[model samples]
Target chain A: MSEKLKRFASNNKQLLIMIGVIAVVFIILSLTVPSFATIRNLTNLLQMIAPIAVMACGATYVLVIGGMDISNPSVMAASAVFGVYCMTTLGVNLVLGTIIIILTGAFLGLINGFAIAKLKMVPMVVTLSMMTIGTGLATILSGTRGLPRLPDSFSEFFNKTAVIIILLAVMLIMDFILTRTKFGRKLYYIGNNARTTKVSGIDSESIIMLTYVISGVCAGIAGVINTASIGTARANMGPQSQILDIISAAVIGGVSTSGGSGRVRDAVLGAFLVCGLTNVMNLLNVSDYYTTLIKGGIIIGAMGIASFRQQQAAKKGV
Target chain B: MKRILAIVLALVMVFALVACGQQAAPAGGSNQSTSQQGSAGSPKQDIAEAAPAEKPAETELKHVKMGLAMQSLQAAAFHAWADYLAYRLDYEAEQRGYEVELVTLNADNDVTKQATDIRDLIAQGCEVIFCPCLDSQAILSSVKEVHDAGLIYVSYCREVSHDAQGDEVPDLTVNFASEEQAYAGMVDLFNIMKEDGVEPVKLIDCYGDKTDENAHNREHGLRRAMEEFGYADLPVVEVECGHWEPDVCGQNLAPVLAANPDANCMYSSSDFLNSGIQKAMEDAGMWHKHGEEGHVYFSASDMYPLGIQHLREGYMDTAVDQGCYNFAVHAAAGAFDLLEGKEVEPVQLVLGTQATYKDIEEILATIPLWGNDYADY
Candidate 1:
């Protein structure tokens, strides 16, 4: 048991550190801010964090496979607008609307994958272009005035608890696939060294493309969840600012942007940490400008500690 | 290749589905062309049927095509204004027996996009263009283009800054006395606080987005009110820049409340920010409606539906209404004058109304609330 515990600690040192940071933030907020540690506030925080956490799960895969998708927000907006139109205007069933939303996101992801894997284009550039295209298409479909209020029953069915359950299920399934599946193993191998994986007769491009598709699907799910939460499908639903939070959460949770390393679970932890900071700051009535400064400082501090730990581990390995 | 082909086929299927859905249920009340036959009658008869009007010859009413370039429809208030404006113009044109084509575009808060939208409206043969510019200075070139085309340029809500090259100024500008209205609202709230015996009022100023011209004007108005009320040197416990977002306002107000737990009042630039302030205050156990113990007096502008509801519930002390109906009516009237070569009056028109909890019902009945249905208008 001791040896196993040691192994777990060694494997997830960064995650452990991030968890520690979250606990410290919670303790400080609880001590200083009245009602900060209440069940009501925590539940509110959970609901607020759900959409970003859902998207981070898919972003984890993209980061692990040596790619970046800055267009996830646009994907969310497009899918959400499309989904709302189907449900509200077309009078499509809830199940079909949900399917259309996910499919729209997956299609966008497929384009990004095709360009990067098959066409040999840069991931950042391709996704950036895709982002513009997605936003434009969303505006055209929904117009400036987004889809009106969805049916109450539809929103009631996808309530806060339902969203939380879906997020948990996604995290568990993604973590399992990443740790236990052959497909997941190839992603890491390709991310670490694509040339080596190719020489060993593995299809690296196919795996990379699949990762993008998974990311796209995740973004689509997030869009649906956001639409339900807000009760309106805005054309500019997923502002780029929120995307920055997701990326920051993923990186802080120990999903290395350099790729080839990280776990799906890390994304959740990162999301909690980011959300917790905002929640505590708001509870404490901290000025937003100062909160922004503090958030930046904490991110940098966390990254610095991570780098230091990595250097020490490298030295010990030598 | 098969995989790629499959992906392409799937995308095409998605687009086809969207197209079908669009056709099945057309969008409602969008600013599109609606053909209306001119009433075959004398000019005097047509003019009499329309609202209190100076009759222009039927020939002078050249099938007026108007364009409105809105900054963004993200905010419900802005969307309500744009929708009502379109409806009002359409109704007016139909009444006047003129073929009117209304083209409205949302710039999504991008200055460059707003400029492009203006140029596109001109190309679409818009005889009169009204834009609430995203960037006052950046839209000068587009305004110049509108002038060069001999089309009437009307600035709404925001005043466009004239270029150094001395290009043609806007034919007319219409806006609310934003600063004075905000100031009046604040002063009214202050009076309430004083009456309640909340001495030594420690106030928090939650201003609007710094980039917005109205925000600057409103802030000046608040200062002016403070000066007039002999509260210029009053203890301003905290000043938060909400940027017109409730979330940002909540975040900014939370810490201020913690530090100044006894803060008696708040002056927010708009109802959107007040909503955030209310939420934060409630969470902090500092929220109380007027006449209740520990009530935090609040003043705001843009008497949107939410603001009016807050007033009805006695949560707000006062709110200023930038009358959307009046704004649209005035702008449309100005466009008509320019189109028919009628003598135009003062270049700038300021309009607004202030409401309080005491007269909330009367105000609601008088003005169109945000999210009001077009049919109701």
Candidate 2:
């Protein structure tokens, strides 16, 4: 049993280091900030982190397959505005609105996938253009104004325990797929070398496209959750800052931006750390200007440590 | 799969075109109706006959094309203000036996876009232009070009400065005195705090977007009030920048409350920021009425509907209405004055109204509340 434990620890050394960093930050915050240790504060932190964490989970998949999606926030805004429009303007049921939101997101993702995977366009440019298109469409669809408040039932459903349970279930399923499925294995291979994976009859393009679809679906879910929480859906609901926050959380949690090396659990851990740091700073009454500086420093520091780890591993021929 | 993708893309394009066509159809119909009226009775002739003795003979009120370049319609307040302004312009024009063609362009909070919008309005032969500029400095050159084209430029809500010192101003300026409104609300809250026997009221100052001129002015106004109330040197527990975002406001405010649990009073830059602060306070069990222990006295600017509702619920102590309706009306009136070659007086108008819980009902009855007409939209 001791040998097995050692093997597991060695296999997840980077994750363990990340966990250590999170523990150190949490312990220090709890000690220094009197209100940080409260159950209420922790619950509030969790609630705030939910949408970003869910988005990061999908982003982790895209990153693992060597792709970048800068359009998640725009896609989220579009889905949210469309969803609210369906429920309020069209007087549709909650279930139908949700389906429409998810499908809208998937369609947006399909656009990115087709352009990047099939047409050989640069992922950055294609996603950036899609972001502009998505934002414009959201603005146009909402008639350049925020949608009216949604029904109480819709928001209540999102705030219930069921929503959190579903989010956890999604994370668990994604983790299982990455760890155990052939599809997941192919993602790593494609990230490592797409040409070799394609030569091996693994259909790399299809897998890459599927990853974007998953990302888009995740963005859709996040949009709904956020709009519900806010009680209104505006065209500019999710700003570009949200996308930056998600990417930073994923990277800090141990997800490789270069792709093919992260777990869903790692992304969650990152989200917790990021959210916890902000919560603690708020509890301590840190100025927002300083908060921004601290957040940037931490992200850069984490990225530095990650790069250092990669270099050491390369030198050791691992 | 590629063929299917192509077909889907084609369908999306077709749908977008149809949507655009539908939106334009109504405007086309309205234009047609206006032209028909013009041909039938010659509204310009009627306007010339009805003109006062001092009215310029050449200034016969015809179809005056006025343009307004708005910052963005994302915010409910801006949307409501723009809608009211358009309605007022149409009404005023009809009353004078003339037609008003108002073209409104949303800059979406982009300074460059605002400049481009103003240029386009000029090219479209807009006789007079009104802009609540996104950036005063960035839009100065565009304003210069409008002036060069012999078009009147009116500024509202924010002042457009030609120089760094703001020595050169627009043709007409409609000021809302946002800072004075914020200061007045704070002063009222302080008075309430004093009546409650609280000393040296601990304040949590939540300012709006730092980049905004109104935000800076409001912050200055708040400081002035603090000084007047002899709380200028009093230790402020926390100062947060909400950036006018509700979510950011709530997230940043929670920790401030956690750190300074005894903080009693808050001065918010706007009602929108107050909404987030109220939510955070509620979650922390700190939201209480005036007489309750641990009650948080709050004051804010912008008497939006949500703020009024909060006032009714005893959550918000006071709010200042920025007089958005009057501001828009005055802007349109100023443009009309310029077009008719009339002498415009009081180049700058500072309008605001203060509302407390005691007078919320009266305020609601008299004022047009933002988001009250969501169903109409």
What DockQ results do all the predictions give, each relative to the true complex?
A: 0.02, 0.02
Report lDDT per candidate: 0.71, 0.70
Q: Candidate 2: how large is its RMSD?
A: 23.0
A155-243 per-residue lDDT for model 2 (tens digits): 67876365576568778888788878998888888877888888989888889988888889988987777665544465655667667
lDDT of 1 by residue, A1-318 (tens): 999999998777666665665665566556755556666566557766777888888888998888898889889888888888888888988889989999999989988898999898999999889889888777677742235556557667887689889889999999999989998898888877888999999987888788888889998998888776545465556766666778877887777677777788888988887756655444433432245566566656555544554455557972
Determine which window of 10 residues in candidate 1 chain B has minimal summed lDDT. B34-43
- B145-182: candidate 2 lDDT, tens digit per residue: 67877888888777754342232357887877877887
- For model 1, the local distance difference test gives 0.71
Candidate 1's chain A scores what TM-score? 0.94
Q: Write the per-residue lDDT of candidate 1 for residues B9-32, one digit (tens) a residue.
A: 333323332333233211114523
For each model, chain A TM-score? 0.94, 0.95
Docking tier of model 2: it is incorrect
Candidate that scores best on lDDT: 1
The segments of candidate 1 whose C-alpha lies over 4 angstroms from its true place after superposition are A1-66, A69-193, A197-318, B1-61, B95-97, B148-150, B161-165, B237-242, B365-377
